[model samples]
Target: MTSDISHVRSLTLDEALHENPVGWFQYRLLLMCGLAFMADALEVSLLSFLATCAGADWGLSTAQEASITSVVFGGIICGTMFWGVFADKYGRKMAYLAASTLITVGGILSGASPSYGWLIFFRSVAGFGIGGASVPFDLLAEFLPTSHRGQFLIYIEYFWTIGSMFVAGLAWATLSQQGWRFLA
Candidate 1:
C-alpha cells in the first residue's frame, strides 16, 4: 500500500490551467473569442438596418420585410440547437470551423441573391453559422485563470457592443452613399 501510494500522481485540470501564468496562448484564445462575438453582433445587427433599405429596393410590403428579417432568427434557433449538439459530440474547434464556413458561404450567397426567396434562404444559412458564436465564450472561460475568469468574459462580451456600433456607422456611411449591395 505504501509503495502504490508513492507511485500515484495527481494533476487535475484545475491545477494544470489555473496554476500557470496567463501566456500567449491564453491571449490568443481571448482574441479569437472576442472576434467571434464581434462577428455575431455585426451579422445580426446588419440585418436590422438593411431591412428598411432592402424593403424599399425590393418594393416589399411590411409583412414581407418583417419575414425577411425574422427568417435569420429562425435560422439562429436551429443553428444554436444543431451546433450545440455537434460541439458536445465532437469538439469546439471543429464546430467553430464548420460554423464559420457556413457563415462565409451564406454571406456571399446572400449578397449575390437574385430574388427575395434566395436572400431569405442565404441569410438563414448565415444565421446558422452565427450560432457557432455561442461556443467561444465557454471555451475561453476554461482557459482563463480562475481569478479573472468572470471579469474577462464580461470584457470580452463588450466586443459585441463594439461590433454593433461599427455596423451602424458602416451602414450610415455605405448604405446611404453606395447602396445596399456595397453594404452587404
Candidate 2:
C-alpha cells in the first residue's frame, strides 16, 4: 500500500508538470492576452482624458461631454452583444485576434480625429473592441482545467490591473510633458 501510494503521487506530479509545459507558445499566448487587456484599459482611460480635453478645446458643455462618455459605454454594450454571440458560435482564438485588430484600428483613427464628433466615434469603436475582447477573455478561463483555471484566471485579472495602471502612468507622463496632444 505504501509503495502504491508513492507511485501514484509521482505519476500525478509528472502529469501536472507535463500538462502545464513552460514553452514559447504559452508565453506568447499570455503576452497576447496581456496586450489585449492593456488595450482595453487604455481605450477607457483615453476616453476619460479626452472628455476633459474636448470640453476645453471644442467648447463642449458638461452635459455634452457626459453624453460622449455614455455613448462609448453604449457602444461597448452593443459590441458585447454582437461579439459574444459570435465567439460562442465560432472560437475564442479568432475572436481574440479580431478584437485586437479592431483595437489597433480604433487607436489609430482616434489619434487622427480632427473634431469632437470624430473623436467620440473612434472612441466608441475602441470601446467595441474592448467589449469583444471580454468574451474571449472569459472563454480562456473556461478552456483551462478546473484545477488550474482559477489560478490562470486570477493571473489574467492581475495582468489586467497592471495594464490599467500602466495606462494611467503613461497618461500622466504624456500629459505632463506634452499636454492634450497626448490624446492624439
Candidate 3:
C-alpha cells in the first residue's frame, strides 16, 4: 500500500500581514502618517503662540483669549467624535483628506481673520481637523506588519515633537518682527 501526502499551506490576513517584512509601502505609509501627527501637533500648539500675538495686535481681553482656546478644544471634541464614526463608515483615507483640508482652510482663514470672533471660529475649524489625529494611526497600524509595529508607532510620535519644535522655531523667526497673521 502507498500513501499520498499534501504540503500546501494557506495564511489568513492576520497571519500574512504579521509575518511579512516591512517594505517600501510601509515606509511611505509611516511617513505620511507621521506627517499627520506633525500637522496635528503644529495646529494644537500654534494657538498658544498665536493667541499672544493676536491679543497684542487686536487688543483682545482675557475673556476673549479664553473663549478662543476653549472653542478650539470644543471643536476638537466634536470633530473627534464625528470623524471617528465617519472614518468607520466611509474610510480612513477620506476622513484623513477631509481633516487635512479643514486644517489648511482653518489656518488660512484664521490668519485672515478681521476680528476676535472670526479668529475663534477659524481656530475651532483647525481644532476639528486636529481631532481627526487618530485616523492616521488607525490606518497605519492596519498596514504595519506586527514585527515592527510597536517601534514604528513610537517613531511616528517623534514627528509630533518635531512639529512642536518647528512651530517654536517659526514663531521665533516671524513673531517678533511680523504680526501673528503671517505666522499662521
Candidate No. with top lDDT: 3
Q: Point out where model 2 deviates above 4 Å.
A: 1-24
Model 3 over residues 51-80: C-alpha lDDT tens digits? 777887888888887777788899899999
lDDT of each: 0.83, 0.71, 0.87
lDDT against true structure, model 1: 0.83
CA lDDT for candidate 3: 0.87
TM-score of each: 0.91, 0.79, 0.92
**Can you write out model 2's per-residue Cα lDDT over 36-77, one digit (the tens) per residue?**
776777777676776787678789999988876786788788
Clashing pairs in 3: none
Residue pairs in collision within model 2: none
Q: What 10-residue stretch in candidate 2 is worst by lDDT?
A: 1-10
lDDT accuracy of residue 86 in candidate 1: 94
> How many clashes (backbone N, Cα, C below 3 Å) per candidate?
0, 0, 0
Kindly list the per-residue Cα lDDT of model 1 for residues 85-140, writing each as its tens digit.
Answer: 89889988788778878877887787788888888898899889998888888778
